[model samples]
Target: MEGRNGDAVSLLERYLKDWADESLHAKLAQVFAATNMLQDSLSHYQAALRINPQNEAATADGPKHIETTLSLF
Candidate 1:
């Protein structure tokens, strides 16, 4: 389980490095959030938003996610 989790993380990191597109970044943020990696998730989300302030998903869904993630602290 641990090794699988590590592999998944590595894959996500590679994806982030290779394709920094907003949608992919958002997906990665969600994955990080699901894994309780709030800081990393927030960072990715912020990057996504920065890349596309007019992003439909970010504009429509990001604030809620950010608030929820922040509340986890």
Candidate 2:
């Protein structure tokens, strides 16, 4: 994010307010994940998956949430 992580997240979230596209959710999840917001990231990934099970990114990343959650226990 080149030190603009907050901006990236803010812009993505703003875009999401207008667009319910799975791609947007997937991207936001990616951003959140990069920022160490695992819960938010996982939730967005799940949201993307819900909208489109075929979303490659969501399918690939969403499952990581399970692994992360398990690691916490």
Candidate 3:
């Protein structure tokens, strides 16, 4: 579990190298969200939006996840 978790994080970092691509960014966001890494997910979502404001999935679902995560803080 620990190794898998680390690997996931590493993959996320690698994905970020090409963060300008909305599709790739959204895919990474989904991976983070699936693993319950809400903040990381939100970050990727935001990055996606930054690259392309018209990214519907990032603009809509990103904030929803961010709000849910923030409420926990």
Candidate 4:
């Protein structure tokens, strides 16, 4: 899991450096959420929403991710 998460972060960061878009941010947020990096996920999710308010995936999943993260505490 750790290795997979690290790879996801690395790939996402590399992609983010070349492109900046709501979809990319949303994907990164999803990756982070999968890895239990809730804060980073939330930040990216917010950035995605800020860039495109109509992002259905982010809008639908972001709150669920946050809720799941919060439940861990």
Residue pairs with colliding backbones in model 4 are: none
TM-score of model 2 relative to the true fold? 0.83
RMSD to the true structure for each prediction, in A, is 3.0, 2.2, 2.8, 2.3
Q: What does candidate 4's lDDT look like per residue over 2-54, in tens digits?
A: 89878888998899888888888998888888887788888888888899998
Residue-level lDDT of model 2, residues 1-73, one tens digit each, is 6468789888989998999999999998888777777788888888998999899998884558645774796
How well is each residue in 3-51 modelled by candidate 3, as lDDT tens digits?
Answer: 6766866886786676558877777777777777788788888888888
Assess candidate 1 and give its lDDT: 0.73
- Relative to the true structure, how large is the alpha-carbon lDDT of every model? 0.73, 0.83, 0.76, 0.83
Q: Against the hidden reference, what TM-scores do the models get? A: 0.65, 0.83, 0.68, 0.80
- Each prediction's total of clashing residue pairs, residues at least 3 apart in sequence or on different chains, is 0, 0, 0, 0
Task: Give residue 6's lDDT in candidate 4 (0 to 100).
Answer: 89
Candidate that scores best on TM-score: 2
Q: Global CA lDDT of candidate 3, please?
A: 0.76
Q: How many times do residue backbones clash in model 4?
A: 0
Ranking by lDDT: 4, 2, 3, 1
